[model samples]
Structure formats: structure tokens, C-alpha cells
Target: MSLPTPLTAEAEDSAGRRTDVLVTVLAFTGIAVALVQTLIIPIIPHLPEYLHASASDAAWALTATLLCGAVATPVMGRLGDMYGKRRMLLVGVAMLVVGSVICALSESLAPMIVGRALQGLAHGVIPLGVSILRDEVPAARLPVSTAVMLGSLGVGGALGLPGSAMIADAFDWHILFWTSAALGALALLLVMLFVPESKARPGGRVDIPGAVGMGISLICLLFVVSKGADWGWSSGTTLGVLAVALIVLPFWGWFELRTPQPMVDLRASAHPQILFTHLAGVAFGFSLFALNLVLPQVLQLPKITGYGLGESLATAGLAMAPQGMVMMAVAPLSARVTKTRGPKTTLMIGAVTVGVGYLLIMVLMSATWTLILASCVVAMGVGFGYAALPTLVMSSVPASQTAAANSLNTLMRSIGTTTSSALAGVLLAHMTIDFHGVELPSENGLRAVLALGVGAAALALAVASFIPRHRPDAAVTPADAIAEKVGLRPAADAD
Candidate 1:
């Protein structure tokens, strides 16, 4: 075969600039989307007062986001694959901006839940961005680029805690959502200016029936997990939702199995490599979110409780800020590891590190510095695992299906996080001690949660260990090969 023509110097420089702009914009977009998850966390305890609602009702602010995100992620991914990734990405970002504005103006629970749910719809941006990178980035640079994108999730979440806490302390809480709106607007502008629409349109009809079925099942499952404690585990509402989830799952499976262009493509997902990766995603999700739940509470609780640090919200946030930095710093290194040892090995290493971090928290919880140290350790592991999970997922699936596949992986992690929150809530609630007329979480309660985190980490490692070893190269679509051959990508990365 004849060799392809080389790009001219100016053309090559232009391609480099475009690639740089694309990666940066998409990574920022991911971070922008992620910030929504943590923005309300600082104000959760006070939500009842602000919204003129009962504690049980105020909790729906968090649950709304989780439920909406769980349902939206996979659907958006499939839509991106069918329509255009860039188009669907823009829609997600726009929803975030709109959601934030509604939240900023809200004075009651109803609007706040609506705003938060809209924000949750944007969760698809990160995975969609991953799929975009798979379609657009040069094969040689894919690992490190993908690592940075995945790392953005940790960075955004890590920074959001401290940042939102400080804002809540200093200003009206409305400012929190306003800030998110501004960030979302910025991400939207950057995407419009720099990010190009992907050319890999695996055009097909959307599985609307499948989407509806899956959405209903996810809503039921997440509703039961998030509200079961408040509704009473044995209550009719909880049991009814749980029963609906169980009942719908089998039917959903049956429908998806029969559909020609199913939303999830269950047949491909059944492969040992993909199946195990998704399971590992759930384990790591539980592992990561458990730290988020435990650290802030342990740091902010009254010192009279003996195990509490009694720090201000802002201080606790500042202490944990290092974790996000550590996550960003370690992500490139994880990419390097993926290049040398494989993504599976990198993930296993992350699991062990996370478990060690939780172990440290158990043994050393008296000082803020120790919490910082332990959390940073956990962040390092998160950086490694988060970066690797998507890599493993994208590598195993067809390029055209990358968005849907990655979204499903993300959904698994969401399931893990929601489950972690529920279990932690239950443990902390019943395991409380009476402190001067108020019930406070006992030391053992906190330890039990930490122990759960350690167990989650170990579970992640075990699940990752079962991932079938494979070559690192991702399957390229014919369009990708054509684009690369025509000098649309950088030759420098080919080194």
C-alpha cells in the first residue's frame, strides 16, 4: 500500500492546537458537571429550614439528583451515539446552567428538587466526553488524555466541598447555585468554541421502550435505597418501591434482549472483560463515596463527642482539598501504569491504596492532619481507579458504542454510591449516642462506616482481579482509521 502524505508544518501545528483545546475544554466540562454533586452537601443539614420542609422531605434534594442522574446517564449516552455527541453534550451543559439558575432563585423544596434533578441530567457529560475523546483523540495520546478527563471528576468533587462550604459560610446559600451556573456557562462557551462534533454516528433508532423501562426500574431502585430509611425499611412505601424495582428488572432484561438496537447492548456487556469492569466500577464507586460521607462529618461534629474534630465546615473542606490535588497529580501516573502494566493492574493497585487509606482513618482519627493524610491516600487510589475504569470500558467496546457502554459503567458506579449513602445513613443513624439532649453519631458508628469503606475497597480489588486480561488497544471504527490516515490527527503522538 502507498504511504499517506504527511501534513505540512502549519497544518500540523494547527492540529496540535486543536487537540489541546479539545482536551482542555472537555475536561473542564466534566469538572463543571461534577461540581453539581457536591454543591448542596455543605448545606444539607440546614436544608429543612431553608426550604420550609421537614428533614425527610429536605433530603430529596440529594435524592433527586441521584435518581435523575442514574436514569439520564445511559439514555444520554445512547442519544449521543445516535444523534451527535457534541449536540447531546451541549444539551446536558445547558440543562446544568438552567438548573443552577432555578436553584439560585428557589425559596422552597419544590423548585430546588426540580433544579437539582435538571443538574443531575448533566451527569452524562463526563462519559460523553470520554466517548468524544475516544472518537477524536489520536490513539497514542488516548490513555493520558482519558486519565485527565476521568481525573476531572475527583478534582471537581474534591474542590467543591471546601469551595461550597466557604461560600455557604460567607454568603447567602443562593450564591452556591449561582456560582455553579457561572461555571456551567463557561463550560458551555468553551465547548462551543473548541470542541468539534464527533464524526462517528452509528445511526439507529433509539430504543424508546427500553429507555422507559430502564428509567422506571432505576427510579424504583434508587428511590428505595435513598428513601427506605426515612420511610421505614418495612413500610409499605419502601417495600412497594423495592418490589417494583425487582419486578421491572427481569422484564426490562427480556425487552432489551429482544431489541435490535437496545440502549445498553446487553449482549456486548456480558463479556467477562466488560462485565467485570462494570462490577468493579460499582465497588470503586462505593469505596470513593464512603470517604466523602465519612470525612466531612467526622471533621465537623462537636468535639464533645470524643471522636469528633469540631472543625468548622470551611476548615474541614480545606483539610480535604488536598485529596483533589492528589487525585489530579496521580492521574497521569496511573495512565503511565496503564501503558506499562495494563489498566486492570492499575485498578488493583488503586483498590489496595484506598483500603489502606480507610485503615489509616480507623487507627488515626484524632487530628485533622491525619484525616488529611488518610484522605489524600484515598484520593490517590481514586485517581488511579477512576482513570483506569473508563479506559478498560472504552477499550473493550465498539467505538460507536463507547458512549453508551461508558455510561452504563457510570450507572453501575452511581448504584454503588447511592447504596453506600443509604447504608452509611442507616449505620450512623441507629448507632448514635445522646450528647447533652442531642443524639450524635458515636465513635463506633463512624468506625463502622470506615470499616465499610475498607470492605468496599477490598471488594473493588477482588472484582478487578477477575477482569480478563487483554491487549490495551481499543477497537477503532473505519471512520477513525480514515480520519487518522488523512492527517486529521497529530503524528507527534504516534511516537
Candidate 2:
């Protein structure tokens, strides 16, 4: 065959512009999906009244979403690997739109819970987005693109809180879901218009049994972690679910190890570098969520409590909003550090920064501005840490396995956040001071949670330190090999 002609300067420029559009759209889609997580936080207190249900029943609106997201993350990742990442991503965003509409039109708890559960599936977008970047974005641009895309998690979550609060404060509560639906629809449209399908398919049949086993185990485990406090730690229901998860996990692993095309590659994950990266992901998750929990409580509690800031919910959200902006700002910086010192160093720095932020929070909780400053510090750490995680995973795994590996990593973080929420809840629940006739979380309890945040950051830093150092020239991943073969990279560089 005749040699394929190289692109002209104008064609290359057009390609560059397309790549930019792809990254921008993907990042926007990530932020839109993430918004679902915090959309209900502002209206949580009034959920029971709106649904005409008991408080315990209404809590399912939150719990269902968490459980669905946990179940969906790994399964969706596996499917994306088998099929097409962009196709799966579109499906995920579609679920968000449908779920949001269901929630918007709901008059009772059942439909609301269903809608939230559907929205949870959108969590898969982030991992799949990162994987797509690996497949399509030029290697030079990959780091910054992935960093910004990953940081959208923090961005959407931070912006959503105050935006949702302000909207809820002024309009009917249904407007929140309506707004979510609109955003999801817009993201879905933009994604279809801009993001290209990934070519790195590691052709494999779905591991049906493995998926089912893993899903059941995760659901049971996460359910217990998230609801154990309210259900009573010793309650049979909680213990039973916990027991099921514990029993199912070993079997799931055993089956996965034997399967030729496993839903999750246990061997790859067990490698020290990938394993440590995952452990660090958990630590980062705990730190991020713990900060989310403690800061808001400290900000919104009655001012009569010596430690509380006594701000309204909207104001508290606005104060926290700067952290999201900081995270976005730190993304490019994270990419720079990853490019220079390596992702391991980036993660370590992030861990240290996060620890310092938590320390600041402990000392600075008395004032809103101080708390904002401390949260911004934590956001910086989270941005750096989140950006580093996928880069590390992608570097180690084959291009074909990126989505699955990244999904598992994301799942680890979810587990960490869930554990943090549980621990913080228990501490705040038991350590409360009487404010008039009601009990409120005591300063000591909140302080303990903040201390745990510090401990989590330290744990992440320690775990990240153990990750094997990456030398760009020393490793050629499957993706790199493919890119080289396909002329996506210069042959000299490939060698």
C-alpha cells in the first residue's frame, strides 16, 4: 500500500482544536455528573416533610444513591472495557437525566429514592473519562487533561452545595432535580457532539458470575458501612449484611483469580505499586469526605454552641465553594508536578498538604474565613491527590484495562469516604452537648473528626511513599506500544 500522507499544518491545528473541545466537554460532563452527589444535601432536613415519610425512611433517598453508585462503578467499568468507553459513558449520563426527571416529578419517597439511585450510576463517568483521555489525547497533553478532568469531582461537589442551597432556599425543592436534569441533558448533548469513542478495547466477554458476586458483596459491605450507625452497630441486620460481605469477598476473589477474563484483575491489583496507589486512594477519600462532613457541621450549628459559626446553610456552602475553585486551580499544578517529580511525589505532597489543612481546620474553626482558608488548603491537596491517582493507575495498567483499573481505584476512595462518614457520625452522635433541650455535636467530637482527617492524610502519605518510583523512559505500557505502532508517537521516542 502507498504510504499514508501526514496531516497538513491546518489539519493538525484543527485536530488540536478538536482535542481541546473533547477535553473541555469531558470535564464539563464529569462536573455535571458529580453535581448529583451534593444536590440533595441542602434539602436533606426537609426530605421527610416533603415525602410525607418517617425520617428513617427518607434517609433511603441518600442511602440508595450511595449503594447504587457503588454497585454501578465496577460493573460499568468492566462493561466499558468490553464495549466502548464513550458508549458506556453516554449510558451513564442518560441514567442521570432519567433519574433526575424521576426525582423532579416525584411526590413520595419511593420515586425519589429510585431517581437518586439512577443518578448514582453517573459516578462511572469520571473513570471512563480518564480512560478515554488515555486512548485519544496526545501523551504530552494527557497529564493536564486528566488532572483537570479528575479534579472536576471536587469542583462539581463544591459548587453544587451552595448552588443547590441557594436554589432550594428560593424555589420549590423540586427545582433541584429539575436543575440536575437540565445539566445532565446538556452534558449528554455536548459529550455526543465532542467526545470521540476510545479504540483501546481489550476484547473480552463479561464475567457474569464475578460481576454479580462482586456487586452483591460491595452492596452489602457499603450498606453496612453507611447505615450501621443508624441501624445500631450490633443490630442483626447490620451484622448480617456485614457478614455476607465478608463471606462473599473471598469467594469473589477466588473466582476472579481463576477466570481468564475477570471483571477485575486481581493479580494486576496486587502488584505493590497499584496496590499502594489504591490504598492511598482510600486515604484520600476519607480525608476528602471527612472534611466535607466536619466543616459544614461546624459552620451551620447554632451559634449558642461555643464552637459553632452559626451560618445559614447557603452561607456555609458559599464559604466552602472556594475549596472547589482551589481544586480546579491546583489541577494544572498537579499535572506539572506529576510531569516533573513523578506522580508518587505529587501524591506525597498532596498528602502532606491535606494533613496541614486539617491541622489548620482544628485550630481555625472559630471563624468562617479561617475555615474557608483551611478548606481551600484541603482542596489543594485533594486536587493534587485526585489528579495523581489515575495517572499512576494508567501508567501501570495496560490501555485496555484502564477503565476497570481506574474504576476499582475510584471504588476504593468511595469505601474510604463511607468509612469516614460512619466514624464521624458515631463520634458526633455520642459526643454531643445539650443546647437548650436538644443535643448538638460537641467541639471535642468535631475536633476528633478533624484529627482523624489528619490521620487519614498521614496514612495516605505513608502509603504513597511505598509506591515504586516511575521512570517514564523505563516503562512502556500496552497503550504506549499501541500508540507507537499506530504512529500516534514518533518512532524515535517510542524506542
Candidate 3:
């Protein structure tokens, strides 16, 4: 089978004798960063006791990381586009290393949460890796390399959960963070040794105000989504935060539109295809997290609940592990679909598959095997859908804006996931079923959460229908085509 190459030979050839090895190392480094993000999940169940935290407070271990990543990703992307990907990547790696080490050595949850926040900056690696493809690899290798790098976003987290579970079960929870620290160290070494400095934006100035505005807006928005359930969704705190987000987001948009070298070029995101991609990213990200968060609760419930399988943390992780592996396996095929039918078609297919997967889960709520099957379907759909998204975004935007553009895409996905987490929490809290007067499904409250996922996937399908399709051999490059649709000047020709 011939692989689609997106990079020119001159680009790949410039790396000399170590190009292949370097690419492999960088890919793994990207994977390690992904692993760190999720490696704590299996241990979440143990955190309350280990850290002497109340159940609600313990959730912050994950929430803090999510909040930090949501704020940092787009900012890092803009910095990478403005300054250098390698520089931002190295900074991210350093943060991850420090965070992991602190978490590994911490005696309390406060320090651990602090560490996780620092590690959140590492989420920038995935987009930076994708942007690197535009700068490095030979044109012939760009498609597959791009697919693999982006696919790692899902694959890394999926694989990390099971591995974390096994490690925690065999050793102790601290070992998981320590192992993550080691992975961070290795990633730093690989990045320093292999990834080349990008020439895309050698001397651009950082847009400090633009970055601060965007960051504050995102933090406010994500804070509402992440903590609204705990703070009372209608409480003054939550409503006030949402209002601030509403006020800041428009100003941030206006700021980006007016800045000569904005942190993120808002004009670039106005394209029909790009806009649809961001909207789809929200739905897709919601589906991914909904499944990840709910399935384990369902599987680990007491068997007396009638619907529960009573699995251990390790068993639950193993059950959901196939989704990640399937996603990895399907990503290359998704790339082919994009190459042949275009991104719009691929996205539609993914949306339909995702909806079908959720429908399957809803139908099989009474069976354990159904959970696994539904996960497989969802993973396959997400792999295809997720792979096509960055391709669509990158193809639509200029190479110069790859990092920032992709980061915005990533940020949208995070927003989706954050909203899903809050929404699912509220829905689960309200939808308790009285099972033999015992309320068996009330512990983790997941069935309602999965139902919300099904709804989100359906919305994704609706959004996918509006994404514009293009022919494979069309005269317009992906970025140009999107630029034209959005009425923006092409980046290559834009001053």
C-alpha cells in the first residue's frame, strides 16, 4: 500500500541521517505527554483515601489539570506559531517534568494539584507535533505522519489508563506519577535531540495582550463548566463566571481581528469548514470524555445493582482499553478516507459512526458486553472523526498558522469535554433510579451520563451535515479552499 506523503523530500532530506529515528522518537514523546494526561485516572478511585481528600475535593486532581490545559493550549499554540515550536515544546516538556516530579514526591493533594496544573501545559505537545509535520517530514510522509500524531491524542490517553491501572495495582499510586516523571524526562531528551527548530515564524513578536485576553476568557468559561455542578449551576458564582466569559469572549474575538499579529487569527477560523470543525470538535470531545467517565462507573457498580458487572479498576480499564487500540488502528484508514473523499465526507462518516455507537450503548444498557462493543464503535468513529479534523484545519489555514489553528481546535475540544463533565454531573445527580427502593445506580450516577453522550453524538451528526465537501484534486489547497469559503485572504498571500 502506498502511503500519502504530505511533506516535500527537501524538508525530510534536510534532517540528514537521523530523520526516521528522530521522527519515531518525537512521536513517542508526543505519546508520553498524552499518557501523562490520563495516567492518573485509574488511580482517581484511590485518591480520596491516599490524599485524605473528600470525594468532591479529590475530583480536583483531574479538574485542575483540565482547567489548566484548557487555558494553556491555545496560548502555547500562538506562542509556537509566533516564536518557535521547538522553544514552546521544550518549555512544555520542562513543565511536565517538574509537575510529574512534584506529584510523585508530594505528601498531600494540594501539591499534586499544583503539579498537575503545571503538567497541563504539556497538552500543547500534540498540536506542536502536528505543526512540526508541516515543517519537517518529506511531503510523501506528511499524511500518515500527521494522522499518527493526531491519533495519539486519543490513543495515548486510552493506552495510559490500562497501563496506569496495572502499575498502580502492582506497585503503588506514587509509582504512577514517578513513571510519568520518567516518561517526561525521556520526552524532553528526545525532543531536544531530534525535533528541528521550525523556520515558519523565526522572528514574530508574542501578542501578550491577545494571549492574556484569550487565556482569561477560556479560564472563566472552563471554570464555569468544570465547577458549575459543585457550585450550584444557577448560583451567583456560576452565573457570574458565565457572564464574564460572555463579556470577555467577544472582546477577545474583536482583539484578535484587529491585532496585526494576533495570538490566534480569528479571521482564519471563520471559514465554513473550519467553523464546522470546531463545532464538531466540541461534540466529539464530549462523546470521548462521556464514555471514558461513565463506563467504569457502570462496570464497577455492585452486582446487586442488576446492571453492574462488579469489575475492579484494572478490569474496568482493560474493558475500555480496546477503544484506544481500535482508534489507533482506524486512524490510517481515516486518513485514506480524507485523501479520497475529502475531509467533509470523512467527518460525516465519523459522526454517523459515533451516533450509532451511542445508540448501541443506549440499546445495550443491560449487558456488560454491550459496553465493550459500544466503546469499540465509539473509538472507531472518534479515530476517524478526530483524524480528519486537524487535516481539515491545517488544510484550510496557512502553514504559518498551523500551530495556532490546531491549538484552537484542541481548545474547542477541551471546552466540549469540560461542558460535558459538568452537564453529565448534573444530569446524573438528577436522574437517579429507585431500584427496589435502594437507588443502586445512584453511587457514581453514570447511566444518565451515557445518555447525555448519545445526545452529544447526535448533535455532532447534525453539524457534520453542514461541512462543505471538496474533490480530492480540486485546485484549492485545504487552507485556500477554507479561506475562500470564509472570505479571508489566503495566509500565503496575506500580509
Candidate 4:
């Protein structure tokens, strides 16, 4: 966390300007990428008619994006560490622009899926942006900058939903992609103009074979989790993929351990500080995503269902938008808590807040205002947890490993979210009541899912509690990291 103390006043002035530009551009880029993820949600059910495809076939549009993003996140992060973080960042955003254009122009299922896969490649931007800030920004501004950047993940997705829903309602669905393309282009221009390439490049060739092995294993594992309900969990195809993942993962771990430049450093990951933080990431992710699954359905279902409020898609989106604003508002608190109480305490507070929010949701979802209040409460917890996670990772690992390490942490959250989606789908499908000719999720089923969310948040709090206390020397500068181990932070002071 040490700095050069700005050898001269003029140099300090220029440094301050660059720091401002860097933080601003990175936060905008994070929002741009996150917005693209949710932009397609409003149109998912109508995708079959829009592309003249079967319902099963149309679902691939969303599935493809998740798979591509899962694989691309860590791979691109490793590439960033080797080449340059800002360079890989630009490449990621460029893919988003290209993907948006393809989706905007598409008239068939194949092109839309391809475009989605391209958009997914941009998922690495958030982690890479954090890594770049670590390298280029001053120690004092680092915590706040990282909090703002991380909060953008929630902000972009929350805001995008209503905006995209409105666009789809008013115009051709293709207009949504066109709008996304325009935003991507704007982000590209800003990054190119303001963000500089990080000088903290690691020296090593990429572990091509290791990367391939890791990618294949992840694709299989996530495919089972994401599509098992549709594919029949016990079917041969699903069983075979599950079996392949189980077998391949162990071998992949073995290979990575032996390889000179591993895709993920197993030895380092095994450290308690990094390990518990990642486990917390998964649990925290699972807790937050249940809100997304439950709110939209309650808002859009038939009012005759008694429990359903019967709002339109656009209105449902608006109902959830406050969560983003809550996350943004909590960003500065994330910085303040981390600086004073230590990231471990901040993360613990977040997990408790998420648990309490879910406890309220289990009772308070009878009305829209109550639901929105519950969502905002959960989002405040997420902002705190998300901001603290990268801080913990960066503090624990060396500067050279920041991109790879943070990317892996992000992937862990994706795994949690995917699992939550699958779990909710199962609960709702089996626990349904007949309304007219259709079966719909019963109120009890929704409560069961919210109860699960509460459990996950509790688990996250438990995991966060296990993180080892930080020593004063936890964060070594990039220059210091080159010659020695990372610095550990001192015990927390009474700030």
C-alpha cells in the first residue's frame, strides 16, 4: 500500500488527473458490460417467435452466453496478466460491440446465439478493470475506486432491465441490441482515450494445454448445472457430462499443479485467506440471485393467483431497479468499512445484512413496496460483499497474480448463480398449483426458495468468519512484489 509520496507537486497534479480518469472510465466500462447481460432477459420468452425457432432451441441464446462467459472470464484474465490488463480490457469491450452488432442484425437463431457468445466474452472486463486500478492507482484511492467499480456490476444489470423492457415494449426487439451496441461503442472510446495499459505484465507463456483442459471441464460442469432440468437430470447425456466433469476436473487439477505456468495456481488458492473468500463469493452470489428469480415472477404472474400482483414486464423491471441504486449508495460505505475495520469485518457485515434481508423477504413479499424494500436491503449487502471480495484477494496475493486471482473469484460467483437458477427452477416446477389450465408456482414454493436464500447468506457469513486476520504487511506494492512476498495488513485500529 506504500507509494512514492509524489516527489514533486507538478507530478502529483498530473497523477491526480490520470487517477480520476482511470477510475471513471473503468466504472463506466463495468456498467456497460453488466448492462449487456440483462438486456436480453426481457425478450427471452419471445425469442422463439422472434427467431422462428422452437422454445427449446431459443433457450440456447441465454445458455450460450452463460457458457461463453464462464470460460472467457478466467482465460482472458490470465491473458491480461501476461500481456497487459488494459489491452485485454479493450479486446473484451470490442467483442461486446461486435456481438451487439451481430445480434442487432440477426434474423435467425444461429446468429443470435453467436452474438450472445461474443457478448459473453466481455465478462472479463470487471476483474481486469480492478487489476488495472491496482497497478496504476494510488494506494489511498484504491479501496474507493475498487468499490465503485464493483458496484457497477449490480448497477448496470438493475438499470438495464427496465430500460431494455421499455425498448422491447415500444419497438422491434432488434432495437435492444442496437442500443447496447451504441453504449459499447461509447465505452470503447472512453477506455481508449483515458485508461492506460498497466506496466505490471507477468513474464511467461500461457499454459495453452492447461487453459484448454480447464475450459473444457468448466463448460461440461456448468452445462449440467444450467441445463439439467431441461435435459432430464438422470438422462445419459446429462449423466455423461456430469461424469466427464467429475473425471476431468481431478486430472485438470493434477496437470495444473505440474505445469510450469498453471491456469490457476492451486497452491496459492489453497491458502486459507483466498480459499474462504472464494467460498463466501459462491454463497453470497447464491443468496443475491434468488431475489432476481422470485421478484419477476411475483410481479408478472396472474393476479387471480391470489399471491401474484400481476404487473407487466416493464413494470416488474421498474420494481427491481431500486436494488441498483442501493448498491451504488453503499459503495462508499464499503470503502470506509474496509479501511477502518478490515475487509474481513466488512464482508462479515455484508453477509449478516443479506441474511436479515432474506428473513424479511420471507415475510414481507405480500406487496410490491415491501418486495422492493427487501431487494434494496439485499443489494446493500451485496455491494458490501462484492467490494470487499477483491480487496481481500488483492491483499492476499501478489500483484502479478491479481488478474487471474480476481477472475477466478468472479467465476466462483457465476457457479453459485447458475446453481441457484437450477435450484429455483426445480422448486417452482414441482411445487405448483393448478390455475385454469396452467400450473403455476405456489406461494409456498416461493417462500421455500426465499428460505433457501436465507440459508445461503447464513453460510456466506459463516465462510467470511473463517478468513484469517490481515497483518499490516498484507499488500506489497507491485515493485515490492517483484522481489518479495505480499505485505500483510496490521490489526484494525479503532477508527
What is the alpha-carbon lDDT for the whole of candidate 3? 0.78
**Candidate 3: tens digits of C-alpha lDDT, residues 1-495:** 222244434433444345566557667877888898778877777788988889888888888888788878988988888788889999988899999999998877899899999999888888887887767654334555666776676667777888998998889789988898898898899889878888778457788888888878888888887888889879999999999989989998898899888888777788888898899999988877778777787888778876677888778877877887787788678878777777777777887888788778766766677889988998888888887778778777776788888988988887888788778777777867686666544633675676677788888878878877766434233333433344432233445
Model 4 scores a TM of 0.94
lDDT at position 55, candidate 1: 92
- The TM-score leader among the candidates is 2
Cα distance off (Å), candidate 3, residue 29: 2.1
- TM-score, prediction 1: 0.95
Ranking by lDDT: 2, 4, 1, 3
Output the better candidate (1/4) by TM-score: 1
How many steric overlaps are in each model, in order?
A: 0, 0, 11, 13
Using alpha carbons, what is the TM-score of model 2?
Answer: 0.96
Q: What is the per-residue lDDT of model 4 for residues 35-130, given as tens digits with 9 covering 90 to 100?
A: 998999989889999999999999989988899999999999999998999889999999999999999999999999999999999999999999
Q: What overall lDDT goes with each candidate model?
A: 0.88, 0.89, 0.78, 0.88
| Candidate 2 segments whose C-alpha is farther than 4 A from its true place | 1-9, 473-489, 493-495
Candidate 2 residue lDDT tens string, 206-295: 999998999899999888888898889999999999999999999999999999999999999999889999999999999888788898
Question: Evaluated with lDDT, which candidate comes out highest?
Answer: 2
Output the lDDT of residue 450, model 3: 68
